[model samples]
Target: MRVTGLASGIDIDEQVKKMMAAKRVPMDKMSQNKQLLEWRRESYRELNSAIADFRYNKLDKFRLANATNVFSSTVTGNKTAVTAEATLTANQVDMKVRVEKLATQTTATSPALADSTTSKTKLSELGAVGNADGKVILEVSRGTGTPIKLEFSKDDTIQSVLSKINANTDAKLNASFDEASKKLIIKSKDYGADPFTLNGEFDTGIMKTKTPEGNLQIGEPAKVFINGKEHNPAQNEMTINGVKLAFLEESGNEESVITTRPDGNNLIGTIKNFVASYNNLINTLNSKVGEQKYKDFPPLTSEQREKMNEDDIKKWEAKAKSGTLKNDGIINGALLQMRSLLWDTSTKVGNKNLDLSSIGITTGEYTEKGKLYIDEEKLQQAINNNPDEIAAMFGGTKEKDGLFQRMYDRLLTPLTSISNKAGTSRYSADPTLSFNEQSIMGKELTDLNSRMAAFSKKLKTTEDSFYRQFNAMERAINKFNMQSASLANFAGQ
Candidate 1:
């Protein structure tokens, strides 16, 4: 315990506290600087997240031909027999579809039991004889592949056998027991014409496979005719010429006609969304770079925060966080590149040079900072006149000269630069994941932390020294007072 101010009547403890507070000024500044750096890193990460969302979700899809050239199909005649869907590459022509046969799965059933039994009934009770070791082995085969062998004790219940068969994915089989029919039924999980066989002691005892035809039924492939050309697919669905056709039922002699047409609404909506998202992203970047910094407001120290209410702290922090990304070179450079790319006239749609202006998309006033403005009526006219050109302009051909491709490629530069500086993970979808400590900003934080630690140690030593000096001074004053009292007593004697 410290006993001060008793001898000299000077509040040494308070004086020492005041001295330490002044000594801590540099430490508080370091704290504020560290906090500011953290805020800037957070801001960069937020921008990275926004850019990733735009690149992956919007630009990736918009650059695809399918997204810009959406197609819808309609079935006219025998619609119930077949359904069709068309892709961007599909030919806009009518196709006749006739489904002669629907696909079926291979199935097998055991002969009725001598007595009614539930799944819980023991196999032995159902007359299932086991081997000498009292174990029944069931071998199941699908197609010409190797058979799956399942062994169970005769004492096991029928449910156990069914569960084992159903759980074996490699078997590709499903097994069940019917209580009312007193029979065991099994079938291939896949729809195909492939042969399925069951051969084992259990089959003889429970499945009664002695007369194979009476117990087993083979599956049939789906027989369909597209434009009078026959196709025998193992499944009911087939894709031809980029058009997917799914056979619902046999049409006998009747034929269903599938017609394809361009879907304008979907294409227009996609373009509109792209424009809106582009504007939103650029606006956010612009605001961040142009935001005003409050020079008077620095990050609060712990001591300062302790003295203020929550509302006051929040308002102060708002000013402190403003313009963390002001005039960032990487962000400003990206904005300029994006604006230039959109205005590039070198992109060609066929023989004609195509640009955003050709499709009613143009930049707003200079004050808007490259925000896009779309003329809807003119855009609709352009789409109506030559939708293929519009699709090629946005999605491009194999040449990759389209606007979406250009924008997507341009975005990569900034994204990479930001990730390198801010330590944001480029591969991960999550922005809040731990920063890479080797990044530029991360290294800066590491240095700050090291310096702060060293300074803190030094501050500790200084505080201890101040307390020791005060203690010595107090002792000296106490000794002097004791000597004065002794002299007065001697003189009186």
Candidate 2:
């Protein structure tokens, strides 16, 4: 602390502080500009996130065939014999179905063992023969796949063997021990006519079973009759004309009938959900573009913030950040493109040109700015009269034509533009990774940072110069006072 102002009778520290404040004006403005740029970048990222949610979650799925076609089926007569499920493209017809037989799995059971037998019983206790190393190996094979060899010591328990068998992926067999009956049962994991074989000493010695040619109980395939024509499948389930039928039991002489039809309520609900999401997204974008800007509310400087309360600072920033994305060219372009796609009627449903208005969807008033409104009654009538046409309209048979597909395709351009301007990492889901620094806004921020740093260094040098000048003036005044005092004393003397 250079104690100045005493010699010159002037407050040197206060004067220098005033001058420095004036010199810092440019630096303060730079800081404010940088803050505004950061806020704008944040706003762009938020908007990108919202658009992505709508595109991937709603539009992407709505353009698929199964999503647009909503249909259901009901089974009448002998419901216990079979159950049916229908997809969107299922034909609306009543078909007679008879389940002649249900599929079964291949299984084998060993004879009753000693009363003391348990899952933990050792292989030696079960009188199993082993190799010279006392390792009892079992070979199990299913279908035409390579056999799985399970090796166990004679001291190994029955539970251990069963666990090894169940854990083997190649064997695909389920092994269990019935403690009550004192019998070991092996069954194939899949239900089919194909047979699995069990070989090796563990099977012959402990199980006391004959060779694979005589001992196995093979599985049987299911037999069913649809419209007086027989169909045999390895499994009990079959799908015909988009209708999946699962046979649960055999129908002796009775036949079950499956009926399918269009579900208007479900289709309406799906469309309503889509409409809600679209409106929500567009509403947010519109609000952002129309948000009012407060020119007087520039970002506060650090020194300014120190003098104000937290609440006041927050309120000030709210106004300052309001118009970061207002009237943005990219966002406005996206909105126009989306509205145009919705209004276009170039695609056709059957022989008639397909349009939102034809199926009860229409835009709101001009002031509302492309908001969609649906007439539910008219939509239901359209669905009931020509459901296929409605499906084709939303989910086009070919790509690039349907309403959802067109919207999805059009959104890519604006999304890409925003991403390029704001910058985004490929791993967007990972919050730890920041936005790419090579983007347009990123490069501008970098340049601004460099300029601010250079200006700050210049300001520091200027402040030091002012302090040096003030000290020099104080030293000169002190020397002059000393000389005057000495001269006056000599004269008086």
**Each model's C-alpha lDDT?**
0.84, 0.83
Q: Cα miss at 417, model 1 (Å)?
A: 3.8
Per-candidate TM equals 0.85, 0.85
Clashing pairs in 2: none
Candidate 1, superposed: residue stretches over 4 Å from native = 56-69, 112-125, 131-135, 142-145, 148-169, 174-185, 189-192, 209-214, 333-348, 380-389, 392-416, 429-432
Candidate 2, run of 10 with poorest lDDT: 424-433
Which prediction has the highest lDDT against the true structure?
A: 1
How well is each residue in 22-59 modelled by candidate 1, as lDDT tens digits?
A: 99999999999999999999999988888877888888
**For every candidate, C-alpha RMSD to the true structure in Å:** 3.5, 3.6
Q: In model 1, what lDDT does residue 403 have?
A: 75
User: Clash number for model 1?
Assistant: 0
Q: What is the model-wide C-alpha lDDT for candidate 1?
A: 0.84
